[model samples]
Target: MSPQHRLTDLPATARAVIEDRTGPLTSVDMLSAGLNSPIAARLLLDDGTSIFVKGMRTDHRWVWTQQREADINRHTQGLAPRVLWHLTGQGWDLLGFEHIDGVHANYTPGSPHLPLVLQTMSSLAATTAPSSIDLKTMPQRMSAYVDDPRALTAFDGSTLLHTDWKPDNVLITGNRARLVDWGWASRGAAWIDPALWVIWLIASGHTPHQAETQVRAHPAWNTALVPSIDAFTRAQARMWESIARTDTPGQWTHHMHQAALTWAKHRQ
Candidate 1:
């Protein structure tokens, strides 16, 4: 990933484009950078409005993710912050979003945020993928990690999925939770989101059974067949194993790998 760039680091042309829409920028507070974007921040406009902005170089390999996020945001309002503007110029592709105030969700066992997260997931589960926009299917994305390619058939569906369930991607605001980072969104079976949550829940100190019990509240959980869930857990274990191997042996990835393996074992 490219090193994160501060708002002031943007080329004059790029900054001008943003200023054209948002008016003069008074200051910018850099936010956490994601794997796909080098620029993530809250830009304060001269008029006192704050908008979250994230961008990548125009020639970067993951530049497509910026476009995908802008397209997906239209379908994710209430569940995600709205996209306010998109601009590409002076070698940068930037997206400005309606600023949201919230903290990363606490996924620990019995955290009050759990219910809000579940509610957000349930709403996402009911959302239909936009047929008009091309989206990678779950089977297409996960096929390489599974032992039997045929096992991926169980992942087929029309529901839209956030896929990435890291605690940081879920923001708890007041009585509700909102998801961010739609760059990895995909089309998948409704149960897939709940299944994905089980691994994160385990990583956050919930036993496999405890995590399973929590996801059981979502109506889609019943639609998840034993064999399909088994296949998914196994596939995820392999995926995270690959990630941990290729990336630096960071504790977060290591813990996620272990959590995936634990879920796979429990399913077995």
Candidate 2:
């Protein structure tokens, strides 16, 4: 991933955008974590307030994700960081969020944080997708993967899903886990989110069967149709394979594809 921009590096116009909403900035601390975006930092204003800022060049291919994240944050009341403001100017697209002081979740087998992560997923599953926002459906997203068009119907639903389950995207504070990075949020069957997490569990060293057992604690996963699960598993494998082939190949992407294939084989 490219190194993030320092607050001092922001152009005058971009700096003004943040100052217009917040008071004069007193200090800036750039966070060096996360894989997406070229800017991620904490802005400290003169009034002793702090906000998390993330942004990318407006002309970049993933620039639209800034707006998508802002829209999704509006509907994710208790689950995600609150969006304080959004700015698009000075050749950049930026979002400011309530700073969350928490540690990234650990998804390793037998970790105590697993139950809290499951509970958070349950909370997200109960939220209906906001009708006002244009969102992508699971089948629409996986159309390039599935061989049978009929299998697509199994993924159709109105439930909101945070399809990216990387450990860095989940923060555990006290007993609750908070989700961050809404760029990949989608509308799909409730089980889809948990199913995505299963692949992450496998990447974190759990066998496919063991990961399935862990996710079965969710009601959606427990009652999921066998055929629907199989279809999604196969579709996910293809999706990862395509990504691995097209995107810049790396160890992480390669491992993720392997994990998806591992889960698909278990489903068979």
Candidate 1 residue lDDT tens string, 139-241: 9989999889899999999999999898878888899999988888999899999999999999999999999999999979998888899999999999889
> Cα lDDT of all candidates, in order?
0.87, 0.86
For all candidates, the clash counts are 0, 0
> In model 2, how large is the Cα lDDT of residue 143?
83
Return the clash pairs for model 2, or none. none
> After aligning candidate 2 to the native by TM-score, how far in Å is the CA of 150 from where it should be?
0.5
- In candidate 1, stretches whose alpha carbon ends up further than 4 angstroms from where it belongs are 1-13
The true-versus-predicted C-alpha distance at residue 109 of model 1, in Å, is: 0.6
RMSD of 2: 2.2
Q: Taking the tens digit of each residue's C-alpha lDDT, what string does model 2 give over 84-113? A: 889887787889999889999899999988
